[model samples]
Target: MQPDQEVPPRVRPGPLRWIAYAMGAGLPERHRTWVLYDTTTRTWVWRHVVRTFVQLAVPIALVLLLVPGAFWIRAMAALGGLILGMAFSLAYMTEAVENRVKKAGYAPGSAQAVRDLAGREREALDSERRRAAAAKRAVRYRDRRNR
Candidate 1:
């Protein structure tokens, strides 16, 4: 081939192409039981962090209202109460992770589709290589016969 010869049209796997497929395969759409639990727990924990403030504040505020003036001490108790409330939340979160692992198995149609696509891609690449090799062989045969 000449130095300036244009490269043949071949599929060169690029990072973007590979990542697009990977992104498609790694969707958060189909949640297994375990995955559902784990994901829910993580989400709930964040929500609870916000809720705990409101939950602890009302009772603490009431007590402070009844008492003369114990704002600082009540604030400390409220912080501690928040920690106590988190125990149950953490337990549920642990359960969710466990459920996810328990129900953790291959996805329904996703795995099969990925496998089929990969197989087709490989077959296409193989065919291209075979065609190129055959062309090279034909050129070599003609050169030898000419000599």
Candidate 2:
């Protein structure tokens, strides 16, 4: 390496660093909560849960609201309703968490510690996903052996 050559500048980390790490590690599908630090003492938080069953209830409710003659339209309306419901629910969750963080007397995503915490959360989620996958594979192997 030539000493005179200028080295590329390192990218400064931000509140979204943990999300990038999780996506990079191939654990984006895993459900986890993430905290974000904006420029305040407190960080932002996000969590994914197995809410499919709960979310599905919206579609079912829509189906129940349909009248008898318009079958196709009923089905379409149900699908659209389900989608809209989920979209609004997600938006509400994000806003609520941000408000909570703000009320906690800290600015969201401001501190170095918050950034590190987000990274740690991503790592923990990645590890959990790997463990679950391994367990699933072990069960499948054992079932095959029994067969």
Whose lDDT is greatest here? 1
lDDT of 1 by residue, 17-99 (tens): 42432222222333333233323442545643444454455666676666555788866776676677666646654343333
lDDT of each: 0.51, 0.50
CA shift at 138, candidate 2, in angstroms?
36
**Each prediction's TM-score against the native?**
0.30, 0.32
Clash tally, candidates in order: 3, 11
Mind giving the per-residue lDDT tens digits that candidate 2 earns over 1-147? 289987443233443644443222211222112223322222332232123335466456758575665777877777777777666756665454444344434365333455567678889999999999999999999999999
Candidate 2: residue 110 Cα off by (Å): 14
